[model samples]
Target chain A: MTHELATLEKQVADLRAKLEGIERRVPSNKLSMVVFSGDLDRALAAFIIATGAVAMGMDVVMFFTFWATPILRDPAKKVEDKDFMGKMFGTMLPKGACSVKLSKMNMGGLGTAMMKNLMKQKNVASLDQMIALAGELGVQIYVCELSMELMGFKREEMIQYPAMDFCGVAKFLEEAMDSRIQLFI
Target chain B: MSEAIHADKVMDLKGLPCPMPVVKVSKGIKEVAVGQILEAQTTDPGSLTDFPAWARTSGNEIVETIQENGIIRIFIRRKV
Candidate 1:
């Protein structure tokens, strides 16, 4: 009985040492978190960052608050009703690079028609595809609780994603503090 | 000797940009059969790092690499 007990103890110790070796080999730079304030410019940046991060083998979390939530809202309702072309290509060409102000640059009643033309001409991705790609690659996208309440948005209004969650600033900050790059956008 | 690919075959990826070569190579190699050689020539400097890593990740064989003058050429063979 004593010899059998010693053999089992040795086996357990070997297993623990092997597990420790595996633990040490695991890489640490695998996590990232970003916060996007409600802005079109920032939303675009966040989308690009999230896509790039996933491709580079890092886990990414993006918290959308205030103005940014609208960018993730129903693509059918939001993008179709506005001047999306000017928002994408901007106005004034070379000099007017920053002219397409999302908050101010409405093409009046002709906004929706311009968006249709732009979508057809530019071959831009729809919001649904962007969200789908983000979700497919394990990007966590959280909608801010305060922003949701302020905007009166329900869960159904947001694009469906497995990583989608509604959380407050406190939780967001806790997650963001550990990330390599935490952007307000 | 210049390794020859069949007349019906060519890896034509002109006007492709960085990080795109990896995607294109990924999609391109799928069309070639196992053990067939693929000659990948790209202008994107990122391919220097990207394609090798991709070859490693996908378990394909990178047979040869050369930098002639300013252009980069890589020869890869499908493993499985």
Candidate 2:
């Protein structure tokens, strides 16, 4: 009987410790999101999430790697430098429609053009504005060091935002693991 | 601004979205000295409900909430 009692006591202690650890690490406020994709929609979504998190009294961090880094490129352009076609269309079309073609991947070139026109009518926030607001609201923007080198982007060429930081996948993974929410946009 | 002006502090959350207005306002109000007033302006329609609910949960008093030009102007006097 004593043995059983001791085991139960140990289990209880273990559970208590686990609960305390969770309470200590989990955010006191709302969700934490890690967005993975760098499409315009993803960019906008990340901004909304980060800004929303901050507005809701939660800490927010965004690790921009891969294609997402272009959104953070200094002399920030409406479209990425890598996609020459996107830039051509971005310059030709009004801002909102610039991302429409990318969204309708199956629609062929014309479909994308139509989508852009439709999106503009919907009053969605422009890609550039979303990036700006994310910076303004103090969203932590981290550039993947490896992705930066591979993309041939110099740190000096990246957009200068107070919340911007640089790190690797491992560090981002560590931070994302502790968050209440993780998003791959 | 009405003459009541019962409290001295102010919090402006105008043009911010849900959770953000609440977040900023919550932080802003916490810093005010007890018994001081906090006035916040929020463009988000949802703050009409969210702010008061948060205020209740956080133990702050919502002295008044008025709507003008589609914006919610809330007056909170820190009770706790």
Candidate 3:
């Protein structure tokens, strides 16, 4: 009986140590971002933060919604079965991650091109490169399902890079609750 | 001005901007074995602070930082 009791106590102590380890790592080591802008500069900011946090050993989740959804769209992928409004949106908005414009002084997209050139000259990684790095570093990219439905975007329309996940605000909120850093961009 | 420490790997991040140097360093450190050193050369002024902060947060050690002719060389020791 004493042997069994000692074994049980040892197991309890081990479990407590494991729990302490988890508590130390969780909540403080996670970063969550709500990426709500499709503008080139804003997307760059989001990716910079994500990559920075990942470099700091934080688990990052970037939830793309609304206007930001286009950042994940594949430039060459076409969306079929769209209603008139959807077709109009598809025609009007810039085609995907590659074609996103700047939020200010875009100058008919020339400003964005200039900014890309500047970034290149300065040796800063482009948005596409940052996204690839995030993927390599295990940063999770999530698409808002509601935003996709409202914007008439199909699952197949998104680029396959980084392996995205689809979820709703509720799910994002759940993640944010446990994350130490949360940003709405 | 001091003698340079031997590094297991050298990563060139010259001309890269804020965050890329650190990002690349973070990735490069993974390629080095524990206790080995990685030497990263960059022109990003931000890395002066970014490298130390990253090293602190990532549990690595920055053994040396050398600045010469607008170039920064940081030697990092992988701790884990």
C-alpha RMSD by candidate, in order: 8.8, 6.9, 3.5
Candidate 2: segments with Cα more than 4 A from true spot: A1-31, A76-138, B1-7, B10-27, B53-63, B68-71
lDDT of 3 by residue, B1-80 (tens): 45569989999988778778888888889999999999999988889999999999999999999998998999999998
lDDT of 3 by residue, A5-117 (tens): 99999999999999998886678579999999889889989999998998898999999999999788788787678998778877777677778888998898788889889
For residue B52, what is the lDDT in candidate 3?
Answer: 96
lDDT of 1 at A113: 44
Ranking by lDDT: 3, 2, 1
Per-residue accuracy of model 2 over B1-80 as CA lDDT, tens digit each = 45555557666666665446775676688788888888888888888888777777677888888887787788888777
lDDT of model 3 at position A28: 56
DockQ for candidate 3, please give it. Answer: 0.79
lDDT of 2 by residue, A1-185 (tens): 99999999999999999999988886544444555555655666677667656655566788776666666664443333545554453344322213323543535566655555665665445665666666776677777887666655656656657777788888777777677777776
User: Can you list each candidate's DockQ?
Assistant: 0.21, 0.19, 0.79
| Model 2 residue A140 CA deviation in Å | 2.3
* Cα lDDT of model 1 by residue, B5-33, tens digit: 33223475544454345545666776788
Second chain alone, TM-score for each candidate: 0.80, 0.86, 0.94
Over 4 Å off in model 1, which ranges? A1-41, A75-127, B1-80
